[model samples]
Target chain A: DVKVTQSSRYLVKRTGEKVFLECVQDMDHENMFWYRQDPGLGLRLIYFSYDVKMKEKGDIPEGYSVSREKKERFSLILESASTNQTSMYLCATPGAGGSYGYTFGSGTRLTVV
Target chain B: SQQGEEDPQALSIQEGENATMNCSYKTSINNLQWYRQNSGRGLVHLILIRSNEREKHSGRLRVTLDTSKKSSSLLITASRAADTASYFCAPESGSQGNLIFGKGTKLSVKP
Candidate 1:
C-alpha cells in the first residue's frame, strides 16, 4: 500500500517562531503539495513541488514556503508563525497529471500561541 | 480562490440510509474526485470521474459529473457509522499536477 508519513501529528509554537512540517511518501510520486485547512475555507494550497528542487506557489503561499530536497520528501516551512496560522496542515501527492486522486499523509495540526 | 464549492455543509443520516453530497466548480477541469476524511485524519480517495464521463460507481459509492454544469455529486449507499466523516470534492486543475479542494460536507451517520 502507498504510505505517506507526516513527521508530527500535533505541534504548538509561539508567535514569531519558525516552524517546520515534514512529509515523506514511499510511492515515488512526482508531485507533492502542502495545504492548510480551516473551518469554513477548506484546504488552501500553500505550495506544490512537481519535482525535486522545484517548487511553485499556490493560492495561499503568502505565509508558507516549501522545499523538496528529495523525491520522497517534501517540507513546509513557516518563516514566522502567527496566531492566524494555527490550522491543520496537510501533505499530499498525486499521480502524474493527477489522473489518480491524491494520497494524503496524516495531517499535522499546528497551533500558534 | 477556491475552485469548487460543496453544498449542504452538513448532513446527518441513519445507518442504511443514503447520503448525497454535491460539488460545483468554476472553470474547466480534467477530472473530479471525491474523498473522505475521518476526524483529525488525512483524506482518503473515494472515487474519480473524468471530464468526459458522466457517472461512475464503485462498490457502495457512486459519483456523477456534469461538465456542462461544472458540477458533480457523490452518493454513498447503505451508510454505516464508519461512514461518518467529512466528504470533500476536488477538481484537478489542468496540467498543474495539483487539485483544488472545496469546503467539505460533514456527514454524521448514526448507528
Candidate 2:
C-alpha cells in the first residue's frame, strides 16, 4: 500500500488561476514538508508543518501557501499560479519521533500555462 | 553550504560496467546518505554511512565515507539498464534532521 499519496500526478492551470495540491498520509507523522523540484535546481522547500494547525515558511515560500488543518492532510496552495511556478511539487512526511530523511510522494507535475 | 554536491552531472555507461558517483561536502557531519530517483518518480533511500564508519555495502551498492576529507562515494557494481537514475548524496547537518541535497548526478546505463 502507498503510505503517502499526492492528489494528482499531473495538473494544468491558467496563469492567474489558483491551484491546490493535496497530500495525505496513512502513517502517524509529526512533521510534514512541501518542496518543489526543478531541473538543475534540485528540491527547494516551500513550506513545512510541525503539527496540526502549525506551519513554517521554507526557503522559497513566496507565491505559495499551505494548510494543515488535520493530522493526516496537508495542502499546498498557489495563490496565483504563474508559468515560472510550473514544476514538480513534492510532499514529504517524516517519522512520528521527529526523524527526517523521509519518503517522498509520487509528485504532482503542475503546469501553469 | 554544508550540503553535498554530486560530481559529473551526467554519466553514461554500458551494462555490466561499474558506476561511481562522488559527493563533496562543505562541513563536518554525523552521517551521510544516498538516494536514487527514476525519471519522474520519487527518490528512494539507498544507503546511509555514519561519520565514524569507513565503508558499508548492500546488495550491489557500496558506500564509503571519509569525514576528514568531507567527501563520500557511491559505487554500483555490475550495473544494468534498470539502474539508470539520478543519484543524490545528503549530508546530515546541524541539530535538526535537515538533509541538504544538491543537484543530483544523472546516470544512463545502456543495455
Candidate 3:
C-alpha cells in the first residue's frame, strides 16, 4: 500500500514561533499538497509542489510556505504562528494529471497559542 | 475561495440503512471524488467520477455527477456501523494539482 507519513500528529507552538510540518510519500508521486482544514470552512489549499524544488501558492497562502527539496518529501512551514493558524494540516500526493486519487497523510492538528 | 460545498452538515442512520450526501461546486472540474475520514485521521478515497461520467459505483457506494448542474451525490447502501465517518467531496480544479474539498458531512450509523 502507498503511504504518506506526516511528521507530527499534534503540535503546539507559541505565537510568532516558526513551525515546520513534514510529509513524505513512498509512491514517488510528482505532486504534493498542503492544506489547512477548519470547521465549517473545509480544507483550503495553502501550497502545492508539482516537482522537486518547485512550489506554487494556493488560495490561502497568506502565512504559510512550502518546500519540495526532495522528490519524496514535502514540507510546510509556518513563518510566524498565530492563534488563527490553529487547525488541522493535511498533506497529500496525487499522481500525474490526477489519473489516480490522492494519498493523504494522517493530519497534524496544530494549536497556536 | 472554496470551490465546493456539501449539503447536510450531519446525518444519522441505523445500520443496514442507506445514507446519501450531496456536494455542489462553483467551477468546472475534471473530476469529482468522494472520501471518507475517520475522526482525526487521513481521508480515504472512496470513488471518483469524471466530468463526462454521470454515475459510478464501487461495492455499496454509488457516486453521481452532473456537470451541467455542477453537483454530485454519494450514496452508501446498507450502511454499516463502520461507515460512521465524515464524508468529503473534492473537485480537481485547475492544473495546480490540488483538490478543493467541501466542508464534509458527518455520518453516524448506529447498530
Of the pair 1 and 3, which is ahead by DockQ? 1
* C-alpha lDDT of residue A84 in model 3: 99
Sort by TM-score, best first: what order?
1, 3, 2
Worst 10 residues of 3 chain A by lDDT: A94-103
Question: lDDT scores for all predictions?
Answer: 0.90, 0.87, 0.89
Query: Per-residue CA lDDT of candidate 2, range A5-87, in tens?
Result: 89999999999999999999888686788989999998788898888999988888999999999988999999999999999
RMSD of 2: 2.1
Q: For residues A40-93, write the lDDT of model 3, one tens digit per residue.
A: 787888999889999988888998888889999999999999999999999998
Clashing pairs in 1: none
Error of 3 at B60 (Å): 0.8
Could you report the DockQ of all the candidates, in the order they appear?
Answer: 0.78, 0.52, 0.74
State the TM-score of the second chain for every model: 0.95, 0.97, 0.95
Misplaced by over 4 Å in model 3 are A96-99
Ranking by lDDT: 1, 3, 2
DockQ of 1: 0.78
Candidate 1, residue A62: CA error in Å? 1.7
